[model samples]
Target: MRLQTDNDMVGKRWRSRALTDDEFDALSAASPEGGFQQTAAMRRMVEQEGAAQTELVGLVDADDKPIAGAMVAYTQGRFGLEGSIWLGPLCDAHNEHLLTAMTMALHVAAHKRGAISVSCWPDDVYLRRTSDGEPDGEPDDLLVGNYEKLGWHHAGFDRGYGSIVNRWVYVKDLSGFKSADDLLKSYSKNTRRNVKIARNSAVHVRRLDRDELGVFHHICELSSVKQHFQNRDLAYFEGVWDAFGDRAEFMVAEIHLDEYLAGWQDKYAKFAREADRLEAALPESKYPDDVRKKLDTARRNVESAEHRIADAKERIERDGHVVPAAAGLFMWHERELVYFSSGSDERYAKFYAPTAIQHEMMSRCLERGLHRYNFYGISGVFDDPDDPGRGVLEFKQGFNGYVEELPGEFTLPVDRIRYGLKAAAAAVLHH
Candidate 1:
């Protein structure tokens, strides 16, 4: 048989090469469904990932054409920690072949980054099943499947231990250790009033900008320093500000505590004030025993609610991005709204912005025909009830969102021997 005269038989489109960082950014920025396309954020992620010791790889086509990209991160300096490096971004055409190539790209990216193996969250990646019925992949549906096809070992399923499934952790060890789902189940019955208050409150939502970033960052800084964590710089916030585009929005729930609600708060305050008046008028020696206890109770309630109202008022006048008080990042996907990140103004912890935001957003999501409103991440730090961070967990607990055991991280072995040696050296050094 005569050999083919032309080489166009390989692909409908010519097999152009890959993509570099600049090309990747241009493609992502031009995409309609892209998220956070700001250059600063990409650089920041690159920097942070580097600090985490991740290998950030950018590829390109034969004529310097940028077509695809991926990241490789080696955690704890162990082969176990080394894996496909990503900051959770997807912006390709997303068909079957392109999908598998992305998986293959992961292998290349991580391997080039010095990882003998790579790990990732099983993000809708297709996995094929063995004759024994294990899920393996062709990379046709998702990335996870490609790993299996490429001879990457399976570590099994896992879960997210919080309100939103984003923070859900999954571990697949080419080095031989995987974390499973016995770790995931459901939500506890313990919730708080703020959750409900935010759930049921009236608030508005809008995407803010660098102008408003200062206030948001102020709150974040206060919360961070109070809790002992490092906060990123203004430049980083600006990147998030630009990248989110329409997707990046903030909410302001006008607890409009109607004249009616305001009246109620005032009425309560009046009662306490009158009691105080009585105590001041009467000498400690002259006041009745029950009167002192009653007066103390009133004072405590007022003090507790004092800041919450002020916060609501400030949000309405200054921010206009308020929620019932339980407000957060509402992840919207295919008619499903997930509650991602959440926070409350200390002044209105009594009003429960946390609950207000979740409940209201849930209603909005449902109205928008979304099936689920996810409360993103939660604290596993509750092992000690008194852990200072325990309060944040409790704040999340108020909403009563269902706990989903999402499959966590998984990995594939690339340079097994090198990875094994790295793992051993790490364990010994750290040990």
Candidate 2:
């Protein structure tokens, strides 16, 4: 702990200091607002990358118990060493006193480290939004005003993804549901049908060993190319796995080609038997019209099953005994489970493997007694059908979740002279 400051606010005294890893972990675990981003594991990941130096700064009570804090990553840039506070200061964000003290503590800590300025994208909600990105009620304008009053420069609410962290996200509240069936009842009809399709198709989801990260990476890369999105390198994921251990899960949905083919073959036989029975009964039935209609439907089912069986056999011959169709990485913190990065092989998209992967993770979340499931980022545009992100939004919405619009990023100047100089230079370069 380098610098300690004593301050009095609202007739109570508070202190700020550098916290140890254990201290930070305790604070994060105890606070409902705490998340994966502020964990000691996150700090370890930053260290492993070697691109930034991480500092865990906290506001403590008289007993030295942390009331609020953040994990700040300092990186040297062309302007100067700049600090970033991502998804934190973990505390009751609505508490103005704590927020003010946290702001002061960050300034002191960053300046002491010779940083010119600090940038923060606090993981605090500015609006409660419906699945369609429309406001559920009123916006939290007071929060923005409070930050500005605390001497932080606020970026006005903007549409789309234009910040280091997404200003918009989708989350599901899992507290009300008691079982997987209850959870399934909440999903859209299409989502439920797709999940059933994947399950009936013999797609199985399992946790991948660390050595199989290359498999996940390959799927993610393929999906990224098709979706036109950037993806992290393998080392980034490996670092996460090493740091978070069991708290991190890399899950893949796979199909045993032989078993899948067998399943289809059985379906074909069942459909053929039903159609044959209906056709034979039709000649003697007084209700011949209804019997003929049933026969037609059953014949169509048999044809569909035959086609599926043929496709399965061809896939088995070409792709070997087992084939991975989709992969997803999930981070489990005490408060919630975050659906992090994911990828799928487009060739097996008809398998609906991603839906199965999501279902499996959500079931695990309910078993763990967690209340929140974060589906993560989405572009703020919800109404435009032609928007590039429409498909992404629709996919998440199928699971029945709401949207959260967070206050955009803010910058707090540590050293006014250096910060001003850097800002001037940035403006000049842009022009």
Instruction: Return the TM-score for candidate 1, rounded to 2 decimals.
Output: 0.52
For candidate 1, the 10 contiguous residues with the lowest summed lDDT are 174-183
Error of 2 at 41 (Å): 0.2
Per-model root-mean-square deviation over C-alphas: 12.0, 2.7
Please report the candidate that would top lDDT against the real structure. 2
Give the alpha carbon lDDT tens digit for every residue of 351-391 in model 1.
55444444455545434544444454444343566756456
Count backbone overlaps in model 2: 0
Off by over 4 Å in 1: 1-105, 109-117, 124-207, 252-327, 330-338, 379-394, 413-421
